[model samples]
Target: MLRITAGKLANALRGTVSGTSRVAAVRCLHGTEESAEEFDKRYEKYFSREGIDGWEIRKGMNDLLGMDLVPSPKIIEAGLRAARRVNDIALAIRWLEGCKDKCGDHQATLYPFLLEKISPTLKELGVPTIEELGYDKPELALKSVYDL
Candidate 1:
C-alpha cells in the first residue's frame, strides 16, 4: 500500500493546509508517521459524510504519483510482462487497460513499449486485434474474436 503524507494529500486535494493539520497532529501524538491504512480510515471517518467529489480523489492519486508513493512505472511494466509470460493474458490485458485509463494521451506513447513485450501473448489470447487494443476497444474485439 502507498503511504502518503498529510501535507501532500492537502496539497493534492487543493484543500486548506489546515485541513490536514489535525491528522498531522494525531500522527505526532502517536509518535510515528501515519500509514496509508490509518489515513484511509481517518479519511472515511472525517470525509465520508462531507460529500467530496471525484476530483478530490483524482488529486489525491496525483499527489501520490508526484510523491512516488504509488507503484513505480517500472513495477507496473514488469507486472504486465510477468502476467503475459505466465500466460495470464487476461491479467496482462487488464493491466494495459488500466494504463490507458490512468495515463490517457500518455498511454499512446507507452503502448508501443508494452506492445513490444506482450503482442505475441496477446495474439495467442485470440481476441482483441492489435488495432482494437490500440484504440482501447478491447472488449468488443475480444467478444467478437474469442466469443468471450
Candidate 2:
C-alpha cells in the first residue's frame, strides 16, 4: 500500500515533485510597519467612501474593532455615518458595542470620550447611542447568579 498526495501526483505527471506542505511559509507584503494613526485613517477612509454598502461597512468595522487598540473617534464617526447611509441602525449600534468592548478597563474614561466625539455625528446621522438604545444596562438576568 502507498499514499501519494495530489501535489505529488501532479508533480509526477509533470516529471518532477519539488514537494508541497513542507515548504516554508513565506510572509507576504512585509512592506512597512503601519502606525496606529495610519490604521485608523485607513478604516476611516473605508467607511467614509461614498456609496458604501452594508456588508463593506460591517466588514470594515469588524476588522477595525478586532484589532488590539480601540478605534479612534474619527473612524467610529465615519463608520456610524456609513451605517446610517446604508440604513443599518443595528450595525451602527453593534459597532458602538464593539468599540466599548475594545476599551477594556479604560472604558470608564475612553468610552465617554468616544461618545462625546461621535455624538454629533451620531445625531446628524440619526443613529442612537448605546445608552439611548437602552443597551447600556442589560437586564436579561435580573437576580444574582447565586439566586439561580
Candidate 3:
C-alpha cells in the first residue's frame, strides 16, 4: 500500500485534486492489488492529521455507497457545536439534516434545541416551523410572511 499524508487527503477533498489523477494515484497505491493489512497501515497514517474530518468524509461516502459503517455520535455532536459556534445556521441545518438518517434516536432531542435558538426569529416572521420555510429561500419566506 502507498502511504498518503493527511494533508494530501484533506487537500483532495477541498478540490486540490482537480481531476481523476489523484484518484488514480490512491487506487494504484491502495486498490485491489493491495492487501488489507497494507491498506490499514496506509489509512492509519493519513487519519492522524485529517482526524474527524477524514472520518466524516469516509462515513459520508459509505452512506452514499450503501456501506454499513456509521459515524460516531460524538463526531456529529462536535460538528453541530462547531457550526453553532460559528453562527453558521445553514451548516447547522445541514448537520441536523444529515444526522436524521444516522441519529434517529437523538433527532427529537435536537429539535427543541434548534427551535429554542430560531423560534423568536421564526415567529417574528410569522413562520410556524422550519419545515414551512424553504431553507434555501429563507429571506423570501420571511418577506412573504412579513411583507418585508
lDDT values for all models: 0.50, 0.78, 0.47
Q: Write the per-residue lDDT of candidate 2 for residues 1-148, one digit (tens) a residue.
A: 1356876787776674233411211111235556667767777888888888898888887766655568888888888889888888888899999999999999999999998898888888888888887888876948778888
Instruction: Please tell me which predicted candidate would have the highest lDDT against the true structure.
Output: 2
Decide which is better by TM-score, 2 or 3.
Answer: 2
lDDT of 1 by residue, 46-134 (tens): 32324444444334334333331333344444444445444555655555555445554666676566566555655655435336657
Model 3 pairs in collision: none
Best by TM-score: 2
Clashing pairs in 2: none
Report lDDT (Cα) of residue 105, candidate 2: 96
What value does the lDDT take at residue 77 in candidate 2? 87
Q: In terms of lDDT, which candidate is stronger, 2 or 3? A: 2
Name the 10 consecutive residues with the lowest summed lDDT in model 1. 63-72
Each model's TM-score?
A: 0.32, 0.73, 0.28
Clash number for each model: 0, 0, 0
